[model samples]
Target: MDGDFWAPPPDVSPPVPGVSEGYPGVSQVMSHGYFQHGGVTFPGLLYSPRSLEAAREFPVEDDDVFNVTYQKSGTVWMLEILSLIRQDGDPRWCRSVPNWDRGPWLETLLGLRRARANARPRIISSHLPVHMFPKSFFGSKAKVIYTVRDPKDVLVSLFHFARIFRPYRDPGSLGDFMDKFLQGDVPFGSWFQHVRGWLQLRGRENFFWISYEELQQDLRGSVQRLCSFLCHPLSPAALDAVVTNASFAAMSHNPMSNFSLSPGFILDQNRGPFLRKGISGDWRNHLSPEQSRRFDLVYRERMEGPPKNPSGDTKIPPGPPKNPSGVPKSGEDPQGTPKNGGDP
Candidate 1:
């Protein structure tokens, strides 16, 4: 189970002498569940050094649509919209297949295999940082949809998420999680680093940058824009269908979309639903005044955001930075032929 993977922060340091399976509600994550690569922390239960390395080398067909996001940053929601768009606003697929399987992840071995074997116009998802993404992506015409959310909201969502997601070590307390989050100790590493690194690349023709607030405020408009970017425009009727079905209230009731299909060991449904409140600004309710002040201070200090961009969930600056930084520098692509699949 340990053939090279990202080492989650909870157990980065040596574990206590006698704590079996880690002390409950403590910060010690099991060794088997993590792996480290290029100083980034990934939940390793589904990943491996070989797997991640392979994904980096995977052949990225021009038809690939990567939904890249940090956790709880509208990852699932965006998938839902994309899935509906792929289906031309049909709910049949959305109601049958789980979103993860429908839009597989690239960091995990399973996702890698599924993707390699998948047909064209595949919807690939990932939480990987830019420097570690698939190498072939740079040379290919694969379109990427990157979503950002208010860090405060992300913090609140991830805190509750940790409670229900078994792969994550207990977040301890809100204060503890906040300390680790600000310090880049959570899964997928520093929010500041992840966002800053990707922000530098928002200008690319193939990349579409969107904020969670934009989605919340105008889902229909956002979906329309995504549809346009995908070059798969939908009719007014079809577009309306997509907006209605992808709504939080609509998706919450859909067994396939809400991740209700997840097994008990993977997700403790009794503790909470996976698609818990799908709104923005919920952080205000969870963060205390002092905590908010502290978070704002850290966010402002860490993020060298575009000028005049509000600190948290910094909006994408009007235009791409002078020299946008995206796609990690690497050697040439492998000789393997990328699999082909038609539009979904």
Candidate 2:
């Protein structure tokens, strides 16, 4: 396994270094099993050894559309947008099922089954890095839309999110959380590595990149571009509907879009909303100047592939070739492998 794929936090002592098979000491904070695989530890609540194994072998379809992101980087928002486009701007159909059901996480234990049972041309989502996806994914014509947010903002949003779990207690001060985040101690591992890994595959025919900042700043344009990439272009009126339906305010209130309604599944409703303050740069309110400077130094050193833009414009150049048909071409499996799938 590549070193970049492993995420071992410095503060939390992992089990004996050589013990690679069982769950590590359970995290008191989240009350979830923490397991180590290939020397990398991840929360068992979302990923288990079985699920990981399943994901590595998961079958992928040519029409499969994956909305990939690190947690809290507008996964739900992109999901809603894709759902609407798939439904041809029919909000009723999009809301007919829970958002989770519409676009299930691909790495969770049951994610693959749920995604497979859904209507043809599934819109699946995952937090797994590019390399972590099943080998079939790389060879298939499946489309992947990876979303990224400024790490500073991701840290702040994740900090508040962790506090919501009863077992997690308060996340201490922002400074403490910032330190852990900078060190890749948080859930999904190093933000730098995650982004860099995916960014490295930017020019692939089936890969598309979008930034949360860009989506927030120009949702209509972003949605239009996204729809085109998915080969599900919409009319001006339909595009308007998608933008309206996917707005933060609308989704925050919708039970389907907000995880708060799920109760024990993920959110502790009493804590707060999952769609908390969707804007970028909110990190300024929490991270001190010194903390920000330190994070910047590390980010510059680690985040090497994509160029950073203040306005969040990380759009790839247009006119990349598209898969003629979702079907297997040559030397590809008729039915791609299935993988364990889920979000952080």
Candidate 3:
């Protein structure tokens, strides 16, 4: 079993957009259970167990583990990879666990059983900040495979999510979501900080860093690399099963894999399905040219080069603006500023 998932790192100086506290109808509304960064309303609180009573200390077996990332990034894809690795690349096993509950996110399963000892060797998933991770998960024994995606895509996905999930009912369009994301008001904290914290833990044998774009570009290669990192020897049969089930076609339609169903633990799904479009570069459809440029500038300024795969071997140049607060200027319309320059 894996140890308690930790919290993501603190936003060094999270952005706080100068949004009018609340729109007339939608102001003061909470989205995804948290207050909008500059919006008027605050989200409700989550009811955590507070404590896992004598949760069995997860044994450090073979010193390999998987810490899947939060939503939006290719989590489902990676989940299938981990499941295949743990199940010795069995398609039958992949079908058994399904995609949504793939091995990495075991902390969520704690609610299923009373004691941790009864739990299987877990490949768990979580969105907890790096700071909040249990101390036991560090070092060589427990590996954390962190998968990150471009923030532009993440913002777009979150926007659609707010629309579908109705978490806070954002009256502001995708522009507003972009503003909030750059501002760092969402649930798991700033995306930059999340990547930064995990990257900081790099160089250790236990850390395996991969990117969504790279995975999308080379699915099987990525899977093979992941399996190698996890020390799981893959047979041709096992590899075939993992590749087949982890495809977008396979996962997008499958209810069990899609995570569309409310698992009771997560709430506020009346707005939209958790798994929206699982494609990369979807932000291009949402962000206007001008807005996309602004996003690009901000991304280059804040998150330049992510760590390379498996090894976490890369040079992270000490950059400026830990939080960057890259939200648009006051009175600027995020939904593509009008040519005449008035808020759309």
lDDT of 2 at 335: 34
- Model 1, stretches more than 4 Å misplaced? 1-32, 305-344
What local lDDT score does residue 158 receive in model 1, on the 0 to 100 scale? 94
lDDT of 1 by residue, 109-179 (tens): 88888888777889999988766677677777899888877788789999999999888888888989999
Model 3 spans with C-alpha error above 4 angstroms: 1-64, 98-118, 166-171, 263-272, 304-315, 318-344
What lDDT score belongs to each candidate, Candidate 1 first? Answer: 0.70, 0.66, 0.53
Model 1, residue 119: C-alpha shift (Å): 1.7
lDDT of 2 by residue, 252-306 (tens): 8787787756767566767677788889778778766777777766764555323
Off by over 4 Å in 2: 1-32, 166-170, 305-344
Query: Clashing residue pairs in candidate 1, if any?
Result: 4-49, 5-35, 5-36, 6-35, 6-36, 7-35, 7-36, 120-341
- lDDT, candidate 3, 1-344, per-residue tens: 00111111221221112111122322243445654322222334421223211112233444435555755666667776676667776656565444534553443334223223324566566555454454355433777788866667777776776564443446366776777777665655567656765656544556666667666766777777777666676888878777877777876766666666655445455656666667766776777888877765655555545422222433455332222223222112223332111122
